[model samples]
Target: MALTSVAVVLPGRPTLFELGVVHEVFGIDRTDDGVPLIDFRLCAERPGVPVEISHGITVTPPYGLDAARGADLVVAPAYEYSDTPSEAVLEVFRQAHADGAWLLSVCSGAFALGEAGLLDGRCSTTHWRHSDELKRRFPRTRVDPGVLFVEDDRILTSAGTAAGIDACLHHVRCELGAAIATRIARRMVVPPQRDGGQRQFIDMPVPEIAGETLQPVLEWMREHLVEEQPVRVLASRAAMSERTFARRFAAETGTTPAKWLLAQRIHHARTLLEGTDLPVETVADRAGFGSAALLRHHFGARVGVAPGEYRRTFRSNERRAG
Candidate 1:
């Protein structure tokens, strides 16, 4: 692949760590060692203005939003918690999307993308803390707080800070080979990839009182996902009436219990698909999906690839590594 230009957009009071992730991955010159280099620039709505950062640093971008108009990729690093994106900035994103440039959001940057209306009817994600607010603010976006990143065609959204690195490297791997992406990860001294998706963050903090009561049941479901347990059985185990359990589960988990379970099952199936030599039938059975056809249906819907295709890709990656 040829060197591509990447435009990074910064909101006022951007999260410094997330911005650094983008800079390290795309901004720095790494072509000396045969790596595919990305021409990167930081852009703001205006040039020559120093934007405040979270840790009291003022970053003055050399270019403005117009710089993103022709870039191959546009990255929006995290904004501050309270920063509502402006319509003009949103237009920059919209225009770029119209031009077929790939748009990516990191952490609270997802919030900005949502405000820009770029994420409408898209599967996107953000920091777990802000995922609810993002969903509430932009009802059109299907906010899946449980995934590290969601790749919806040209738009890619990653969960908070470090997940930005994962998302970026994942893109590199997708465009370049896994060898190139892993080489970059080795140079950066970060894990090439983290096992499991952001679904692991689902249990981070138990809600208070009304929502708190379902934590135990949620944890149980995660632990016993392979079991052939029905929703009524799960509700019975939680010691709540099925109707109450259904309502409370949605309130606390941000999704229905069945959907959550299916997501977990699919996630597990993906892990097996990527990391193991198991057949599709065995993978589906182990993940509680019962049949390869069922695995194909849900896995294609969630991961956007069939289990066999995913396994073949991973096997190709392993061959490259070897």
Candidate 2:
């Protein structure tokens, strides 16, 4: 269904960062780019009353829980985990899901959905720090702490702060089109999609980049994505030993050479699917997957959809616009 309206349910002591992320994705108007305007509403349990936020500031939502009754998408931003959400808020979630509206939660917001029983028997996730508690409290919900986000049965849950951006963009890409999603990402100055997962943040150390050491090599890699990039070849290009190059690459990119290359190939394949009518085999060959079967395998794993299905969804949107 097209996303025409969005309602954000703000619980007490809402985390400012997560609330900002939701507003940035849905509240901003970009009609000049042919993007559809979403009627975004921020609703609270008590309208016209100021609620304290995490950063010592207060916000007064203009609408109440009743405003979220029939929104196409309902968002729950992160709130204080110790506080129990009111039945009114939980009822909105239950009703939204029953009405077939897309439900999204960021960080501790997943707990509200869990309390409402909306996440029962569905795959979901939350911030890694609270994953165990969520699993213990809602045993019926499959909580994956490693992924940045998970979309199962129209319910979306994101792991932590920035991961919320990834989940929101993924929803836009699926519901609107990749072109519209990409335009939003450009305006926000963030990547359309992020690679790897929340696992990168579990215990990783800060990377140290001294100077313009890896810029040229990274640029070269992007230009030659379709070619074989063995560790030795890349090492030679960077004027370093294979072992040092591999170590430094992981330090800088937060992923191994093979994994990063595969992600880039998949991203290129998605662009081809959205913008061109190229055959799957041809797209696979051009994106360095070498064959249609290999492309479908990786594309399905990363995108949660087959290449042809993705093409049909985005190309149909293109036709409608034209």
Candidate 3:
């Protein structure tokens, strides 16, 4: 049996919430439900040295850099805005990478990982507020300010505070299975997963309350995706010209209305695929795709797998024939 161990490194002025996230996911006993349990430890470069946390709590780690180097996974939790980690922390992270351990950073901890040169030429994300600074500081790292988390092979970086939870849950789902990850999410009273990327968090201009905007029409479009209509019809419903509506819709939703509608149609098609025994052609028609070929093309492009394959792969365990 393979033993999974995760070492969470603590630097000065650590964000306690991020540390607690690591403990919640890895440090606790989770074997009651037959889920894989991890050997998780809190480590620091200078072992046994008292450290002050964000919420007036002080902590001391029994393990040091040696523990970090030996763990299967290394996690760096959040750091303060003004903090720059010591060379000791950076060197330990580099050595951990050299030893082939998976590296994860939550929120501002990506700064430390970047300093260690792991994120060079790699796509990464941080709290949206620091994306500019992270780009300026690490010119080699491609900073994506909009994603909740990015999984680039062995290195994963998450955005903002609560996004750490999403990234950790994603790891659980990837390493274990959706069933185990869903169980863990239920225990934590959080959603099992979120569809789409982090485009929802990207800043957008809110519609004026007194002015006519796309809000009502957008909700109506969502309700009537099965009614095949052209962009002109949608524009008419929103009381704007076709070109104006298209631009405004993109501004409001961070994507074009046509693309958004296609995404919603694909989402509905996936639900039908997972929940029903309907034929692919019928599912396509119901999702307003008009043909299975179109559905297959878009579905495969978006999901990286064909529809029938996805059905067989992700079919609910209870629904499977024994």
Candidate 4:
């Protein structure tokens, strides 16, 4: 699938931030950058009617839920948690799932998916504050308050606020390609990928550090992905002892240097696989994996597919044929 169409179900009092995230990622026109144009539709229960959102803010969408006939992706942003979503909203969710449209929820929007029985036997999440409530409401769904977002089968449920961006960009990267996702992310001025989970947000405080940020070192690490990145060398580069550097790195990235480097390598490998016709061995070497077998093992473990298969499905020149 080329991801040509995206329909967002704007329930009453939808949060401006989550709604804006979907619009900004898929609705905004970026064709000049060679990004694919998506058909972004705002379908609501009350179409062409003023729906109050935010604090006395009103957004009147043009299309009703019935109008979203062929959406490739269907999104639900944070809805009022106290109200069980209307039958109309739930119907749209069920239909989209039956149609195999990619379903995503931002923040408390996971409640709607749960009501639609979409989250039954699926892993889902909401805001950490609401994670227990979600689990209580939909006991069959595993509510993980730890991760930023999760993708099981086709449903993607994200934690509060900014985590929605991670989920959307992740879908773009998986379905479109690294190039397209990177383009959208760059325009938004956010990281193309963030390594941390949402546990940092739930009662976790930032530890005071005496040294400067490791941003420069991180930049250097990405640029030198093909080269060896021993933690000792990285620690030395950061002008800190290994112990202090390790602590700072964990606080900043929520992962160790080795795991981060592995992820970067896999990401770089994916980019290479999609954009070029390089042999797998060459790509592995270029991405710092050193050999095709090593690349296959780690890539399959992380991506759930062989490199060749992923390339065939999402080659930069074309889109996946859904």
Best by TM-score: 4
TM-score of each: 0.65, 0.89, 0.69, 0.94
| Candidate 4 per-residue C-alpha lDDT over 1-322 given as tens digits, one digit per residue, 9 for 90 to 100 | 4588999987557888888898999999999988888889998877889888867888888998977767988998887878788888889989988988899999999998999999999888888899999999999998898877888878999998988898899889888888888999999999887642424367666667787899999999999988899989999999998998887887787678988889899989998998899999999999999999999999999888999999988864364422
Task: State each candidate's clash count.
Answer: 0, 0, 0, 2
TM-score: the better of candidates 1 and 2: 2
Where model 4 places Cα greater than 4 Å from the true spot, the runs are 195-200, 316-322
The global C-alpha lDDT for each of the candidates, from Candidate 1 onward, is: 0.77, 0.85, 0.77, 0.86
What is the C-alpha lDDT profile of model 3 across 31-138, one tens digit per residue?
A: 786567778888887889878885668778889877887787899888785777888988888888888888889999999998888899899999888899999999
Residue 191, model 1, lDDT: 57
Global CA lDDT of candidate 4, please?
Answer: 0.86
TM-score of 3: 0.69
RMSD of 3: 5.7
Lowest summed lDDT over 10 consecutive residues: which window, candidate 2? 196-205
Q: Model 1: what TM-score?
A: 0.65
Better of 1 and 3 by TM-score: 3
* Residue 20 shift from truth in candidate 3, angstroms: 1.7
**Taking the tens digit of each residue's C-alpha lDDT, what string does model 2 give over 256-297?**
788878887987898889988899999999999999999999
Displacement of the residue 113 alpha carbon in candidate 4, Å:
0.5
